[model samples]
Target: MPHYLGIDVGTSAVKAILADERQNAVAEADVSLTVSRLHDLWSEQDPEAWWQAVQTAIEQLRAANASAFADIRGIGLSGQMHGAVLLDENNRPLRPAILWNDGRSFREAQELGAKHPELSHAMGVIPMPGFTAPKLLWVARHEPDIFRAIRKIMLPKDYIRLKLTGAAVTEMSDAAGTWWLDEARRDWSDAALAATDLNRQHMPDLVEGSQPSGMVRSEIAAQWGLQGDVVVAGGAGDAAAGAVGLGAIEDGSAFISLGTSGQLFVTTKEFSPAPEAVVHSFCHAVPGRWFQMAAMLNAASCLAWTASLLKRDIGDLLRETEAAYRSPSNVLFLPYLAGERTPHNDPYARGVFFGLSPATQQTDLVQAVLEGVAFSFADAKQCLEQAGTPLTYAGMIGGGSRSAFWARIFASVLDVPMVRYQGSDKGPAFGAARLARLAATGEAPEAVCTAPSILETIEPQPQLVELYRPRIEAFRNLYRALKPEFVRA
Candidate 1:
């Protein structure tokens, strides 16, 4: 009856999931978190809040199922990737963490790229403002006193691990987003680090995602009413961990994640860097594997924004859009609410609703938003295919995928079947728990990490695919025509 605990330090909340040996989640808990936007394009969160959220989430889990909690054998972590958490010598936070979506470091990102012209090739990503290196570079230039006092740097979940076990360690998958890792080599790159005025000493020791990084301290265990010797697995970035959760670990396995930001992730057996195409190439959560990714900065959040704009409940709006979703609309939307990542890499990109007319209705706008996101996924899919990761089918996860109408739109636009797996909604936390089980029992991942039973396969509509093919081209052309105006305004 031993159980494993998985904790995900997400953008908006901290989630805890408990899983037994049978691969079923026994209990789950979550604690909400807040982001600070004191200035334009700046997103910060106190690291202390993350720790409190974790404690609160664990407490809730322990209270809900005390017996199951008491039998917790190990713990695993998954977190929002690319967050910059600076720490002093005492392992105390020097400043609020810079979040993954923060765009304040855009200039620094450009500066780094200027200094290292081949950075995208070496790092397997075009350095973006949301990356750790540019954030650190901004700190060094603007907050010189605070930067000078720095002692360590950690990603979001690794910061929690520092509080839990007094260990500062990271894994390859999370580190890959830092713009400091030599992804092909699976280690930190000296040239990349030096460009940001950093050295190897500033980084945590690297481990693969399934290995044990540390053990929970006795005080934490006692406070949480858990075992004292529970090992903490080297967990993954949210993307890699989500892949593990969806059983997308094997070569050529893929999934489309429609979270706050959406991604098309494809696993590979070897390191195949495709920075020229602006796709992310990173190490996989599984050992000796890598993945190439294409992402959009906005997805479900776009729907949420549309709902807010029209002053309607999200579910109600989604329900009403079902009819419009199945029909063609002249209106098109750009799902670039927080700018874009894949293909464009332009932080200046903004959301736009084109082709609006006097006859436009709320339903039409909602349908446009759904189709816009689907088109964005199509852009990402093409990037992966051009990078040689031919995906005939992919699984779908995240909040947007929960909508059958939206899932159908994605299938039609991508012209590929979308498979929905049982227990797909558990996301990264579930994957982390599976890794925890691996760490606790010395079990082989292949034996434990198999795809869940199929829920339903969404097939593409041939007519809709043809309809979207022309619309997709128009969507790109609109972006092209409006890019200058977006920069100007």
Candidate 2:
């Protein structure tokens, strides 16, 4: 029996899912890694940790005799985007990899926009410090010793792919998030590269995610109890993979993922920047396509914070929402734990309880948190609208989507329908499985999604939408008002 393995490297962990040629999931294993936060909003992870976690997951997956990898056709990769992995002349990591969650790159990001005004204009927006380009610049300025040791720069999954196939390459989907790719043209932007002092030669070769990186090296194959010569497809950025996992294979489909952070991702046919440049535009994993994305710095992060404050399991709390949704909660939560990106471009934004009173119960807080996350999606979708991206409905997936009430609230708040997904709500894993299927059998992603079984289609109630509309307007305004305060505080 031929199978495919889809491996997703995320912020907290590495997950591998086994799928048959038909793209049906059979077995899955995940291993959690750690992120170390230090001074100056820095987030670093030991790259070796990800490698060890992946090896452990593979060993565990190999233990499933019924789901053995003896004849696995291919492996697909999906990982967190924008995190920088600097390598020396021999491709060894120089130091800890700076992660997407790290906020220390703000000054460098501003410097990039200032130094390369024309390039910024061409890209439609200036690069943010949290992005790869600015992070690279930071290394060059502050840690030239580490920077000079660099021969190649790789994204998270790119490094993993290098380990598996002994090849250095990056897929367009992941590269687009680097702030170095000419997202519109689907290639490296020479002008942008020239402006930055960092060397373009340090970057790996670029390829589309669907393309095969190479055969898995014999050593890794033997270590994992698998046959050598298995084709390893370069997977996509998390957003593209997540969208693919939710079956958002074409334009017009949208997905609201409620995970570490919240994001509204819409599939599109071509490059289209938001008018306000509040959103990100990146190439899709499905080839010849793109996506418009709005990501809030906090989503489940907000829920987790609130849950920790009250000492409760988010799931248990969400169960309480069954009754809470019957009547709107009076509290309004601002889901801005790490500031925000979409529609505001302000990283100094912070969370708040705009309307709170003694009458507000735990249920009200939970509802406010859920609705607040949904409010970011509404803002994201509106940003897409400003860019003329069309979205008729939204498919909801991720950790938070497990809450039926939250899913319903997203549908209600956006005035758009939302879905409740069963099985693997982890988008990158399932989507990687689908891509592995394509690599093995050459089937279209859409063809695999033809069998439609929606868990729920929550429609917006007119009165509820009308009432939430004004509140949403206020919610959008609150972030701006609090942004200056976050910077000062």
Candidate 3:
């Protein structure tokens, strides 16, 4: 039987999986990655590191199941979005990739938004520091030498695509996050590109996420012991790939992704722009579809940060916090460790633990950290509602979704049912595999992108929901109270 390979170039790690024709994961591997934060509000990674990680992951996958690896017929890619991977004329990275969480371009983003107010609706959202366009503006202003030499710009996963196929290509879903795509037209917006001092030449060739981008290079195929003519699908950005993983392709289908960053995403058949509400309206991975998303820059990474700071195992801390959870945390946390993106769009905002007392323990802090992330999602949910896509229920997926405790907190805080699917934690890599299958077989999306079997449905407990309501308000008010300080500091 033919197999498909999925590769996710994530912020935290590179994950690759081999899946059989039935979409069952036959083998998988993960290689950890590190981000460099040499300056405040700056997050970057060397693109060469990503290439190395992908190679390592592929090697591990091949070692895990040699037969399945050799039988791979197609590959799909997914990765963190909006990362600026500037390339010189030789297709070499100009510098470390400016990541999605990097907030160095706040002023540039504001200027772009002010100068091109009309482009917001066409581009699907107002320019933000995290988007690729503003990053380019920053480079143009700060690093003129590098900017002048730039011949191409690619998203994180597309950079890997270039390595795999020697083709500079991108798909609609990933392009949509760059603040350069006309969301309604599903193509690059020349006007938007011009505002950033770039034109179509700076961008890679576009393809639909389900379409074949290129064939895997012959040397790569032979080195990995692959079969003949393996096609690479035009894959999605991480969020859209997560949505695809959850089978959220139809109108009104909604899901929450609690990855390094978080997103509350809702699918729509028509283009929906809600930039005023700070919701991202972007193309879905599949053709002729769009999604409205409320994106939060801080999510699971906050938990990981706290765990690393406290020098405790995340699982152990979570269990202790769950045991100690009698009511809402007395302490309120603003999970802006890497700054915020959703409602606030405040890059200066820093993480805070308010209402700490002498009686507070590590467990309380841990609970607060988890609650703070969920509270951000609550803000995201409200933003989605404001954007006219209210969520009654949402499928949940990501590393954080492995914790039932976190899921419970989210369901109560959002006041909606949270559906967890079997192997949901596999997330984007699994979705990429499905896309690979679609690209290889020319299958209908509805037939191949079916939702996995539900593992459990987590519904909000009325009492907890009522309790969380006030806490959620307090969470909002606390942020409001600290807004000035966040800017001043």
Q: Which order, best to worst by TM-score?
A: 3, 1, 2
Q: State model 1's lDDT.
A: 0.88
Q: Specify the poorest-scoring 10-residue window by lDDT in model 1.
A: 320-329
The residue-by-residue lDDT of candidate 1 on 1-489, one tens digit each, is 999999999887898899988988989998888889898678899999999999898888878888999999889899999999999989888999999888888999988888897878868888889889999999998999989988899999999988888899999999999999998888999999888888998999898888999999889888888765899999899999899888888989999988778889998998888877889999988689999999778888899889989999989998888855556669999998878888888877889999999999999999999999989988898898888888799898776777877888888899999998787777889989988888888888788878888889999999989988999999999999999987797
Report the C-alpha lDDT of model 3 over 1-489, residue by residue, as the tens digit.
999999999999999889999889999999999999999999999999999999999889978999889899999999999999999999999999999999999999999999999999998899999999999999999999999999999999999999999999999999999999999998899999989889999999999999999999999888888889999999899999888888999999998898899999999999999999999999999999999999999999999999999999999999999998998899999999988999999999999999999999999999999999999999998888888888899898999989999999999999999998899999999999989988999998999888999999999999999999999999999999989988888
Give candidate 1's total backbone clashes: 0
Q: Estimate each model's TM-score.
A: 0.97, 0.94, 0.99
**Model 2 alpha-carbon drift over 4 Å, by segment:** 65-67, 120-125, 443-452
Q: Over all chains combined, what TM-score does candidate 3 have?
A: 0.99
lDDT per residue for candidate 2 within 354-433, as digits (tens), equals: 78887878878888888888888888878778777756787777677777777777777888777776653667877776
Measured over all alpha carbons after superposition, the RMSD of each candidate to the real structure, in angstroms, is: 1.4, 2.1, 0.8
The C-alpha local distance difference test score for the whole of candidate 2 amounts to 0.77
Candidate models: Cα lDDT each: 0.88, 0.77, 0.94
Which residue pairs in model 2 clash with each other? Answer: none
Please give the range of 10 consecutive residues that has the lowest summed lDDT in model 3.
219-228
Candidate topping TM-score: 3
